[model samples]
Target chain A: MTSATRRHVLQYGLAGCLMGLGSKSLGATTSSGVTDSEIVLGMSAAFSGPSRGLGIELYRGASAYFEHVNRQGGIAGRKVVLKTYDDGYQPDPAVKNTLTLMLEDEVFALFGYVGTPTVTRVLPMLKKFQERQIYLFFPFTGAQPQREPPYGPFAFNLRASYRQETAGLVQNFVNIGRRRIAVFYQADAYGRSGWAGVRQALKQYGEQIVGEATYRRGSKFTGVMRDQVEILKASRPDAVICIGAYAACAAFLRDAVDLGLQVPIANVSFVGSENLLNLITQGRDDGERYTALLVNSQVVPSYHDTSIPAVKQYQELMALYAPSAPQELLTESYTPFSHSFVSLEGFLDAKMMVEILGRLGETPERGALEDAVFSITEYDLGIGEAVSFGPERRQGLQKVYYTVVDEGRFVPLHNWQTRFA
Target chain B: MSMPKLFSMPRLFRKTLFGVFFLFGVIGVSTSLLSIYAVDTHLSKEYEANSKGIAKTIADASVNILLNSNLTALQSLIDQFIEIQGVSYIYITSETGEILAHTFVPGIPEEIKAGDVNSTTTVERSLPGMGDFIEVGSPILAGVAGTVRIGMDTGLIALKIQRAIGQQIYLICIIFVVGVFAAIWFVNYAAKPVDGLLNFAVGLAREQSSDGAKSQELLARNDEAGDLARLFLHFSRPTDGHGKGPQSGPDRSKE
Candidate 1:
């Protein structure tokens, strides 16, 4: 080869090597690491795990909102960066990933990290960080600990809690004069938390759980659920409450119908994934036979209808940034209720982060962000609800929008004037 | 007396052409695939989000209608929902399984009929909040009460995604066709230098017996061809007759 050619080859090889090394170093640095022009928020979600759909939905919702904010010159001229990591709904990796974001990457906050077990494991670490005063807003879990005092000061809950949701579910049955109620709950913290709420709500009616059934998560409870359905039927309870995920809830409904036990089947919000509706109607000869399906609910403003200002804004942003997406796909059916929940919450969180950043006055320290969240009172998101936080109450949403499943979709029943249950 | 066709082209020129073509082919194909994947992922996520957003909008509008005491308003709301870009139907009911309003085909069942609502029949499917209906519920006013359910036809979204995927695949196919043609051109160009070298060796062999005395003169030309001529002379020495001798043959063998 010519001398010049040999030198050229050597230079190209060195350039390739240098590029590879640079990428490796960049990859090694966690995404949460913020710079002067941008602040990164970290999220670990069940992107590929059992609850992967929920995680993916949450990510989509959060990303849509963030993309919109960033387009509008971002929050106070500092671009918001959401660095999402998928933990596959597992707790160990979630804790590890969260710690890496907090310690190594130094993210300004942790936003919308999903899953109950996953968030539960990281609670202690989050508490430590909170002691140092870091903001963790709108974590996906509605577990009581994350919302109760001590840890509640650090965390901001976006969804109506299982307690609040269950109270709403039971209150619906109570409104219908269904005095004898039974709860079929998953045997976990989520189910227990909801069941506790149901029990507490029923106490006001001078009654208790007339019939209760529990099943493990991810287990096929068809036969067990059938037995529970039969037992619940025997008790002749006016309504059946389901405090579980979509799979369990769908299976219970399918099996209950098979057993010919017909009653109002109430469910928690977690069971509200749109896939469940398809599962329920998949092969049924009478698609409308499952018309009595009811999903107890909480949701933000709908993004499908252009009638609402907030929903219209959400659609406009989604179109601008995500134009390739089908216009119809922007509807609420596919995402279940998560799009409304996360988008509204994510926007509020973005606003709150901006407010906190403003409180710090130009250059923000982590301490100022924490104080800002704690100091928030009646921060409204234009959805007719004001988010308030105090020393005692960390959960911002006091109102729950109770919705029901009518004809294979969730329609709002009404906003409860008083907190149900 | 005719020079070989392959040896007519200079080896360096042929090799340079080959290197350029090969580099372009590799870079082009890799870039196309990477771009397609990135675009596809971005679009799929966008599609999913849009579907969810549409569903939420219908639910919200329905909820507002239910909150108002006007059943006529609720019916108008359902009609508006059906008029929405992607909505298929909107149904409203009470927690007691009473079908308050519906936007469906004719022949509504007695159980789901508007006036003949089934108060005895409760919603039995396992959904989130318990009620007789599917989607959102009208807040219980002093007298107003019911559930507002909105159903969206997702086929439009699916069709949109399919079109996007089809467009991507078409682009990918175009790129692949271009890639194949480029690869063929590259492989041919890359092999050209080797062809030239073979012809040069044949030319040297043909002239070998004719001008032993003039060989040194031929090798003195200060070009790539002359360099090869000199190397050939050094290799064809009597001691390297077997073409595997220790001294000069090893260097040629290394080449």
Candidate 2:
């Protein structure tokens, strides 16, 4: 070969080799859990544990939306599928399930993770694969840890935080001229988050929690309620804010009534409103009177409120997708999960996800997904108010609404001033 | 009693020593400076990343507190964050430009309160009490609740850089001293053969018989001194009628 020809060949060959190396170092973009005809999302939540009502209802609701979209040929002609793993509401199992979903199943995202502890445990693992841009979207938690830095980048929340719920609850109590407030909390992240929110809220009125009692996380009464009742009775609080699972809170309330510690009680939306009501009314006298003294803070509008577009859509869609499910059902297990606030929230979350994904165009990736979500500015969710986000804002909802049980059904309280008036 | 002249270094030896000093010194100083710069840049980036992370965290925790107008809890959180090393100050302000909770003394500046900090903002400023610092600000509930800002003291980073530079200087000084000793040994070893050639030439000039052995030893050497030794021996020998030199002269054309 001529000298010039050899030189040219070497030059081009070296350049090509260097370019290949550069691309390798930059890493190839491999889209996981996505295909031409389908996009799969992964979820790890309690499906066979004490918190089963919440996880099952939430999943069913979101799935209902997904099914509805699938019937309409899906978003951009790609059918959405959800892959769920039952973690029993424990951190270790949740971690294992998440790893399996991410590494083995290769899911697009960890969508709708259920509990605060489970989400907290999954956060460090999320950081390890930050480059992959695989985020946990719209987890069913309102804990502050996931909403903060180091974990904020990994997860996005759609619901109002526990802080908002607790603040609303506490503010209403204070406005009604109720002092000497006590807290009954479960000993875990979820309970503590609610407690912290209450403490933070009460600080504004120059009041502090007069009494406090605790139970183990996920405890089912199991003799812990009697001691808590005794402590609460001793404090003689005018009102008690309950931060716990539905069963436990119901047991505590029942015990409090038996001990003649007659007082008004408040609970956050995460307490499983339907489940709590079922537990309170089952095999009990004075159920209506006891129900009247209870108040719950909800992040979403009432499920029966058809005046709202989202609520009407939820009801119609529920009728179509979950025809057998009643508006509210209390089964033999005493846990309730049929057409409730939790399910409504899940449905709303799915709607938002679908909207963002559709706007992302076909073959949506992680960066584009984040951009679409963060760029949302006062976008209507078919609910009364609009939801939004920003570069520093990850959560979408802010308002907290209050509800009280009346004649075996939840009815919205008009306003905080009404309680005092 | 005076030191031998052989111990005294020549101009070439001095030049070689100076050259080594300048070259190694430049290399050492440049390497140290580059390393210092690289490490400082890396650390500064890490600090900035951490600052942003902290600011975001505080903002997240502040939302409900701000919404509830719980200045006491917000203040407690700010005070707790200030206890972290390198954190100089933290503050929160409502959306309507009211200072809710803060770690600032004499309250937040009016400009900061009025500033439209929509996203995570970072600024470097010098002020009284806190000499030089990096301030990071983030919104809690944008256009809803409030915003949070944190300040990090730069003195800690500067101290880290200074310590790194001091260590580099210490190591480079040791390398320089060792290099000086090595340069001395090398100069002596190289000049030994040249000195031998000089002695052989001087003996030949005085027509001393003892110079023959010394000149032969010098000629056996394979260095530049051997060539001069051979030339001196040739001129010292008796010339033939044909005006030719000694036939025993070594061939050095290859060299």
Candidate 3:
């Protein structure tokens, strides 16, 4: 052949490769956050702040599940990648980080967002970009906004509402004949949400709160705990339900015990059970009497409860993924896995997300994912109960389990009936 | 032998009388309607403000007591709210819609079901036995706890409106009655010159001198009635000041 004919053949081959690359880019751009070999998700949580345990551990648990799936040849042969930004649990930064995730990173959906304050700020941005159809799945709050109308359409919750948690606590207490109740809450949306739940639950038993006190939203529990303890002590309540974070709750409990007030203090799961226990038992006695009296409502079952299929799976997954947990997490009190309620909740949320995504077939679009979540009805999540959703029901978990700190570890309180009887 | 003009009235007097009555009627009706509208609007706003205020206070006190299982305190709180002037019923409800303490018999209204306490909502409803009342739902601690509902009787608002309307009606009636009397007096005073002119014309037609003095007095005045009287006096006598009267003239007046 002539030299001119060989050159013409090489040019034609180069143009063909260019057309193929262009087509791939067009296909990748058509889907919001899906590519030929990847599905990218975005999250904004407090990865580096005072609340890092919740945000970082929740991310860790979720990433562990995602990594496990990726290693098993990925979901539908496409790797799940989560890009998270540290909002520091503040609303302003949360808004900026969420917008960056939506606009710059161009992620498909928002997953495992933490805090009611942060989520509240993120919602308006979602509303502004509603046509984008960014599904906020399993936010770490039972605040009413995520469960009610307007915002409900955009949010898919995995845990029980604060109302349910407080209701369970109130019901159990009332069953035990503890009629005189008081509330200690942080003065914010999260605290108020749990506070509301306690009220709702008590109302069912034809009872009302005897006293209520509040600490500042982001207080470090130094000076405010005294006032809260004093206020609750004055009420002489049979039990005090605390709607606050681990530090504040731990401080309040410590002060209450120090003041010789021996009433039972209850906390909802949002108190971060492991963190709260760590705070309570950090420098305190190993078998403090207050430790046994402090009860907490857990949205997820006990980390050591291998009887439940989910707990077993969670432990196995944690062992496989998080091989080097912090030293403090391995203390004699609670050693069944890293053992953080927030982490377990995050794992469950990711597990459910994978379940829903797996059900949506190979190529799930944005709207299809949302519709699939709503269509989930009576679907068992292997935690001794089934999660269901409909047009009206957005919350997946309705049952709340109670646990008390004993010997510096959380133990399931399954005998409220016999004890009360 | 000319018959007196049947029911003769001065044209000016008739127009003035009709105009006065029509103007008074428009003013009376407009004033009455405006009074009713103003009274109703003010009363409605006042009742709504009062009802919402009571509902908010009850909600603030309710959540703590509800959670603490203080049924007695909750009951006492509701009782105290019930004593507020227009409050017909007050109730505390769980987030699940259970009523803890309620002054009403049937408990929480169906319109205000559970999960209906997300925000501050108010509705004017008429209960079967409670009569018409404005129902307000305020969430305890921004709806984190539960809801407090207060039903303020529309009876007081209605009564206020009714009393205001009655007073307005009475005032309007007084205005109308006074307006009628004033209009009559004004019309009579305004028509006196016309009456004089009419008598002058009648005397000219009958060739009489009794009404001449009155016509002279009317012509002395400076008004439309005076001008009319002057014209009547001028035509009744003659073009000249001392021309022949109707008795000696060609007697066009008799014809």
Candidate 4:
């Protein structure tokens, strides 16, 4: 018999077994408990933790996009139901919540799950459900682990990863003839990943990390920052790479200034939180003694650029969907990096999914969906880049634009495409 | 030789072993495919970016040379374009199809004559700096109106891609081997309980008789399976035990 026929027979047999076992009751349902018309998507994010700023910003962005979609009559005529759970930047609860979403809530797919550890825990579970054809997109982590296939086919990345962004940042630094770099990281996966990139980039120049320091999450680091300042003072490096959140980065900068370590402090894109510059400026105890030391790289374009087509579209969407949010929040600095492009990314991926669905012509099986994603080529997202997928490569956008904090604003450095170390 | 049975197969343990092996096999194939995809994507992107960079660099260098030089010197320097590693040919022309300078390969059409400075040629080919080979007449520079054409062999880019793919395949193989072992260990861990239950069931099925001594012996065996057996025995004999016997055994089993 043909492979198709054999597959049909096996499917029939599996269906018979499932029916006999009565495992249909194991499926998760919604609040109204509807399974067919409503498509539920689960997202676990750092909604109320130290990283809540990013979490809240991303939520607002994704919500705005979904609201716009729903208002426009939804995807393929079916409305998307986003069920968000707060993971509080912790992994244990994140795993529990994810299990609830998958096993109890039975979401159609997992969209916008945030954090590396949280997503890492769910990888095996996601692999198990690969046969069900669950699509995971814009997982907040830029860890290469998520983008590696068989996981990559199901998981799509929206933001450029820390590795890609850091490479751009370091290359720009190198272009400007700055070596003798110091690194201040969060002592976490996110921090270390960017650190790895920085180290790799600096390797080309025959330079090593001259000075290093780290901060534990949620700990007050005034004294620790003082110590780090002393270390950086001793090392006297040309640039200090900060790979922590806004608060930690702010503390380090303030302390570094007090210690007379007047080196330029550059940071990864994660430090692009709202009012980060305000915090740095606030830490400037004297009025005229403003240290010319603050610099942070931005992965996305400044939302303030009203001239950009993508930004214009985002503004329109925000006005229509999330009118309650302040106009300033939608400004260039305050807007989430992903906010500028998440909807567009979603639309592009959704478009691809629809094409695959059309190819399947009504009920596309899981294998067909996999094939469609794998077989993609010249798939233009209409944002900035075109996406192509083949038997071996799966990442969508590999380019990152570096911007430094200039006069309390992010100034564009030259754009650099990502490369593997 | 002795005649073999039509459907001879291995024992239950061996079957389970084969199942585990098959599971790993699926994971390996899928992982291989994934790694290939990841590496190919990474390299192709690198190649495309590199090509674009090379093109831009060549274009920039040509513009710089033209901008720094006057018309006579530019005409003399145009001949030096071939000396650049990736530049194939350089053509300098006016808005009117005048052959200001020409670096030609042996026997192409003489579209432009030396004194024919006022005739126009249509743009035919979509070459980088100028247009196609046949109709290469349009003016690139507006006021000065000169064109510089450079051709690069994409062989280096291809070689880079190939090298990247090879490296990636090796990395993927390493990851695959490690992942397979991890998957096997994990599957075995998850299936341990089921394996224990199956063993217990087989043992029960092979039991010679369901006598009092066997029942006492089963009760003495106080693990989870023994508790299940005791409960089963008590349920089968409705009135054999003292004061709610089935209830006690079931309550204990439930706990």
Best candidate, TM-score-wise?
Answer: 3
Which docking class does model 3 fall in? incorrect
- The digit string of per-residue lDDT tens for model 1 on A18-126 reads 5446645665322223444566677776655335556655666566767767787875566776655656666667888787668755667888877665666676687
**Candidate-wise lDDT, in order:** 0.58, 0.75, 0.72, 0.54
Ranking by lDDT: 2, 3, 1, 4
Model 1 segments more than 4 A misplaced: A1-33, A129-131, A219-228, A282-285, A301-306, A323-359, A414-421, B1-255
Write candidate 2's Cα lDDT for A1-421 as tens digits.
2343345336534643454455456653225666555577888777665677778778878888988999999988877877667676777778887887787666777898887767777887899878878889888878876677656888888899988988887877877777778888765556657767888788898988777777755666334478778877777887899887877888888788777787778888888888788778977677886676788889899998899999998988987887221112212142335588888888998998888878778667876778888878899998877889876888998988889888898889886455433
Q: Candidate 4 at residue A110, lDDT?
A: 74
- For model 4, how does the per-residue alpha-carbon lDDT over A1-421 read when each residue is reduced to its tens digit? 2343245336534543453344236443222212323445677766554565555565666666567666776555545556666666666667776776666655556777766646655665677876666667667666655666435556766567777766766666666666778878665445555666677678877877776666655433333477666766667787788777766777787778777776667776666434355566754546123235555665455565656665566666766766222222122223343333323333333444334433432333334555666666776544556666555665556666555444555555433222101
lDDT of 1 at A309: 62
Q: Model 3 segments beyond 4 Å from truth? A: A1-30, A221-224, A323-337, A417-421, B1-255
Model 2 ranges off by over 4 Å:
A1-30, A221-224, A323-336, A415-421, B1-255
Poorly placed runs, candidate 4 (over 4 Å): A1-36, A128-130, A149-154, A220-224, A282-291, A323-368, A414-421, B1-255
Give the per-prediction TM-score of chain B.
0.52, 0.84, 0.79, 0.45
Residues A1-421 of candidate 3 have per-residue lDDT tens digits of 1233234324433533453366476764335666656677777776544455677678777877888889998878877877666666777778887886787666778999988767865776788899988879999987777776556788899898888888888888887888889988765556656766787778788888877777755555454477667767777898999987777888888888888878778998888877767766766555466586788988988888899898888888888878332222221222323757788888899888888877666776787887788778888888987998877888898888889866678888988755333
Clashing pairs in 2: none
Candidate achieving the largest lDDT = 2
Candidate 3's displacement at residue B91, Å, is 21
Model 1: CAPRI class:
incorrect
Q: Write the per-residue lDDT of candidate 4 for residues B1-255, one digit (tens) a residue.
A: 111310132244346656766776787678667866776677645544443454344334345434542232333244334455534444555444543333442211234332233322322233333333322222344425454333333444355557766776677678766765665455555444445444444555675346556455655565665666665555555454565644444437344
> Mind giving the per-residue lDDT tens digits that candidate 2 earns over B1-255?
123543476666668767888899889979998989987998888888888888888889877766655443455456557768999877666776554555553223434545554435688867654468888888777646777777789998898889888888998899888877777777777877877877888887888764466667777777788877777877887878887877566558736
Cα lDDT for residue A362, candidate 3: 78
Model 1 RMSD in angstroms: 25.0
After TM-score superposition, the amount by which residue A296's alpha carbon in candidate 2 deviates from its true location, in angstroms, is: 0.5
